[model samples]
Target: MMKIFGKVAAIVAGSALVATAAFAEDRKSYPAPKDHPLSEIISGYEFRTPETRALQDDDFENPAYILLDLGAELWSTADGAAGKSCASCHGDAAESMKGIGASFPKWSKERNKAITVEQQINICREEQMQADTWKWTKDPNMLGMTIFVKNQSRGMPIVLDNSPEMETVRKLGEEVYYTRYGQLDMSCANCHEDYYGNYIRADMLSQGQINGFPTYRLKWNGVGSTHRRFKGCMKNIRANPFKPQGEEFTALEAYMMYRAVGLPIETPSVRN
Candidate 1:
């Protein structure tokens, strides 16, 4: 009976060791490679190749073009007791909207907080237009209007002002970008920096540029806003994602757009 008990203990210990080893192996197996390194796990999902770059520059139109047209109409149409069109308040979009997107996710002195582009739009709706606040993500008018507004600034260089006021917002964005989180225990840098250009099971990595967003993804079968794409990436990491147009994501988008300072806008680009 003593010998049998001893054998059982040894067997249990051995099994525990094997289990530990398996867990370690599983952890390492994340971001699995298609090749040893440098090869994409998804062979075709590589970054904008020169060919794709050309496509980004080409004047290929999208059915979603109508979305922008509608937004432009909304911008000019007056509403509420204020009897103010968005244009009546802010004037023509070119002068009124220049550098707005790039400068957003910035600190707002009036609110004493950071403000995203969406929030800025809402502020105008409430304070200037005396209009009801638009809901986020689900509101086609809000999303389409913001997208249209942003498109007006296409090709403008990201020009977020670096000031003492923005110091805290900038730092917070940097912290979020570098901190490891979720089941995979990876930061943005792990995939974008250390493993960039390497295959993760099947797809090649790009420089992780956000400049080309509101992109037309093949997987989605249509164009998607940057916030939508951001949620997908957060889901891939198994992290609980923030709401689209939420503060965290707004900060992240600002940071990422800053990173891709020179990459041109690639609205409606095809990607895997």
Candidate 2:
């Protein structure tokens, strides 16, 4: 009887060990190559080939510059019932918008949320421009306004201060980054962290940072916003895409900016 009791106890212990091991394996099943090393991850700009880099170097050649010029016109031109152009309130784009891109998806007290430059543009449009806000796909003007604003902060490092009030928002964003979704049962980290530098067909994956947003994509043949890329990634993994400027995407943006804190802002960057 004593021998039989000892045998039963040993079997239970072995079962417990097996269960624990399984749990651990599940937790680490899809990890970044270096566990998402902050120091080692390079900017997408760095991942570019010399030919692509050269294209981005010339302001005249980069196609995204057209939007920059348009944005300047939109900035100064008056519209809407208020007849208040962005310039009427803000004075000058260079002076008023400098380093502005680096500071957003910063916490907005009035909105009680993280707001991106695009969202801010619309907000200003309704309030300041007294005009309609431009949607992402239909209008090139949105891209124009966005890249123009981002260009002011070019070369400046991304600055995201996760304040005490914003702790929950940032946490939510982090959860979104790691949480698995879609048919592939993968998260952003699975691609950006785990598969960085790996080829997904012809394209090599980078850390998936948005420091170079309002970026020109060869795939799109046009400049796209950070949220546009987010939706694309979700769709690629067979997940339902979020609204272009939705709250969840804003949270994700906040977290991504944190992930890429200290990285230089490189607007109108070229990507394949």
Candidate 3:
């Protein structure tokens, strides 16, 4: 598997090096909300090659489905001291989880802060299942379960909380998005907002939207969450990344979702 992955990586890197001289011109435009910063919104999907998009469109071809299937199994398999499964409480996820993913990073009244689906999964495991929490980016079970739940909301437009509390969170995220960080002194906006569609070494910078996470990236050779992507970008800029599931990332997730207001949920989306 490592050999295969290394070969794929080398080929992708080689192609990227060849394409470095050209700016991407394949971005699809969508009308932004009245109050949005940009006049248009673009999904990261548009930045990928047609082959990758085709993989995302075909359930059988998309490698992410392997993990999604695991999530489906985990949903029914009982676990922890309580001997309860997610299916035990939620019943049929098709019915119970529908549209839930599109409205996540929601204000948690009990926690008194915005919480992500990843965090909520751990909360359920600890409080209800009496099971240990899965590591944010390291656990395949967490990534699988997250994508499974999100897949239920595929094609639904993203709709986020607009309460004053959520508004504050969104504002903080926006601040983080625009703030320069690390040795390179680059901000998220420098690539995603300003140079989107332009080549950055071997990759085209997209809008950096989070609507399609936990996405399947060819570079990772597997599925991963939005926070994983966050950590990667931070490292690329030579900054110390905040911990996954921490306040900063949660706030950023909330804000990015807000930016994706009308975009359809594309869970298990395939990306370069």
Candidate 4:
């Protein structure tokens, strides 16, 4: 009788667990329409430029290119206690580092955390190069170096490797992507995916690609990093956004890059 009772209990517990999991899946939230100018612009139907049209080959010739050149020089120069250049460690980014930038915000088993490529760069400096780490978004050296490295992967598809370890980071990123926040109550996907190719005020919406980020924005009248673009979007939603280099932004970027998989990198892209 005890054995039979134990079996029944086990079956009941299994059923309950399954039910719980189903409920969790059903509650999964995604961005939806809310009353706001931005939200209306996103969901309202109107034509806009395609991703191909927003990009121009000449975009690289601007001042951003000059900064990129400086970054390359810094990359090859020796620094740190070991007197090793970033190149000495990572080797030629054009070849060795191809398709790398798009794979960032990966789960780090050693640290038991999700880490960004910027974080990994600093980690390498601290461990391999015996150098001081750069501030998250403050260090020009870090920004320049990262931009220089990312440019090496230009035209490569944004492919992010997935693993069990990356599940948490990916989920967090997905949550951010779909969750409505800020006073406007809008998410990234609401504009880019569901309402892509629509008009938002005078500006035309593209596919909202991230592979070409760290791009040149006509609105900014200059080239800016991906984080800058991110903050702008968040602010449009009226959300108190995190710092560009913070964890929230990192996860969001990871999610964006993952979605852009197979899309070629288009550094220094032009936007209206």
Ranking by lDDT: 3, 2, 4, 1
- Per-model TM values vs. the true structure: 0.73, 0.84, 0.89, 0.73
- TM match of model 4 to true structure: 0.73
* lDDT of model 3 at position 118: 88
Clashing pairs in 1: 39-199, 40-199, 41-199, 41-201, 41-202, 41-203, 42-202, 42-203
User: Model 3, 214: alpha-carbon shift in Å?
Assistant: 0.7
What CA root-mean-square deviation does each model show from the true structure?
Answer: 11.4, 10.9, 8.8, 16.3
Best by TM-score: 3
The whole-model lDDT of each prediction reads 0.64, 0.81, 0.90, 0.67
Candidate 1 achieves a global lDDT of 0.64
lDDT of 3: 0.90
lDDT by residue (1-272, candidate 3, tens digit) is 99999999999999996776343444666789887877688888988888989999999999999999999999998899999999999999999999989999999999999999988889999999998888999599999999999999999989978889999999999999989999999999888888887779988788898888999999998889999999999999999999898999999989999888888899989998
Select the stronger candidate by TM-score from 3 and 4.
Answer: 3
Q: In candidate 2, which residue pairs clash?
A: 32-194
Q: Over the stretch 95-175, how does candidate 4's per-residue lDDT look in tens digits?
A: 877776666667788988777767887888898889888876535676677777778877665667588766666668778
**Candidate 2 Cα RMSD (Å):** 10.9
